[model samples]
Target: MSRVFDAMMEGLRGNLLRMGGRAEAILDKALRALWERDARLAQEVADDDVEIDRLEVAIDEGVLKALALQAPVAEDLREVLAVKMIATDLERVGDLARNIAKSAARSAANPPIPFPAALTSLARSSQRVLRRSLDAFSRTDAELARAVLAEDDAIDRAQDEVVESMLRALERQPTAASQEVDMIMVAKHLERVGDHATNIAEDVILVAEARNIKHAAKLARNR
Candidate 1:
């Protein structure tokens, strides 16, 4: 029975990794479409979202089956629950990437505006956060997952700067409001990607350390 349970866990982990890899790739493609102003690539990103959705459903079903058959306890239970949470985060990341792709397509239709430096930094930072979070999960590295959490604040700041700069641009060139607004939406989507990555990192910490850090800050403040 233990052997069967172990095999089941391994299979679930493999599926989660495959899903994460696909989500990461789709995110990269979406960003490339935005940067390169490729409507075709943007459309591809939207079309690829269905794959992530399918994986999420599969992971959910696997989790239910594992719970019913294995009745995982303690760390095993934590691992199972964390995998489900991580899959949900990855699914949201895919959705946000599709939103960015839509913004990219819209921006491509209009005359190109100078991409804000802050927006560029936000995009890069968010992508790095997401990649690092996924890596931490793959290795079950609590330290790396904590580091990913630390980086989330900087991504948030970068996003704010991007928004402020875009607003200023809006003020200066009212005629370009549509492009600026699209850029603002793109920045927002990227920030949300960072948020989802942070959630994944938190789940990694849960599985690695048996700690639930979600809402820890708020809980501490209330205390």
Candidate 2:
């Protein structure tokens, strides 16, 4: 029975990792479409959401099964619950990426707006957070997970700068409002991606250490 439970846990981790990998890919492709103004790539990302949706369903079922059959306790219980919650977050993250891709496809022919430097930085920073959080979960490294939380501040700052720059650009040239709106939407998506990754990292911390550091994270970063 113990062996069966252990195998189930392993399977759970494998499936969750697969979902995470696909979610990360979705964000990457979405950003690519936005920056390069490639309608084809944006369409491709929008279509890929079907796969992510399927994975979310599978993960949900697996979590329910683990809870019913194994009756996980302590860290094991945390892992099971975390898988369920993280799967939901990853699914939403995928949707946010797809939303950006859809917007990119719509604006592909509008003559590329002057690209904002802060937008690029936000995307890169969010991407790093997602990658590092996944790595921390794979290694069960709480310290690495905590560092990812710290990096969220950088993402927030970048988003703020992007908003300010966009506002200024709009004020200077009201004709550019249409383009500025899309740019702000893209930056907002990237910021939300960072937020979802932060949620996942929080789950990892709770699962591995039984520590609820989420509230602390908000206060610490605000300070």
Q: How many residue pairs clash in each candidate?
A: 0, 0
Q: Give the TM-score of candidate 1.
A: 0.98
Over the full model, what C-alpha lDDT does candidate 1 score relative to the true structure? Answer: 0.91
The candidate maximizing lDDT is 1
Q: For residues 1-223, what per-residue lDDT tens digits would candidate 2 score against the true structure?
A: 4888788878878988998899999899988888788999999997888898998898888888888988988888988888888888889889999998987886786766787899888989999999888888888888888898889888988988899999999999888787888888888888888888888889989988899777885699899
lDDT of 1 by residue, 1-223 (tens): 4998898889889889988988888989999999999999999998899999998899999999999998999999999999999999899999999999998899889999999999888988988988999999999999999999999889889988989999999999999999999999989999999999999999999999989999999999999
Give the local distance difference test score of model 2. Answer: 0.87
Off by over 4 Å in 1: none
Best-performing candidate as measured by TM-score: 1
Residue 162 accuracy (lDDT) in model 1: 86
Lowest lDDT block of 10, candidate 1: 1-10
lDDT score for residue 133 of model 1: 93
Q: RMSD per prediction, one decimal?
A: 0.9, 2.1
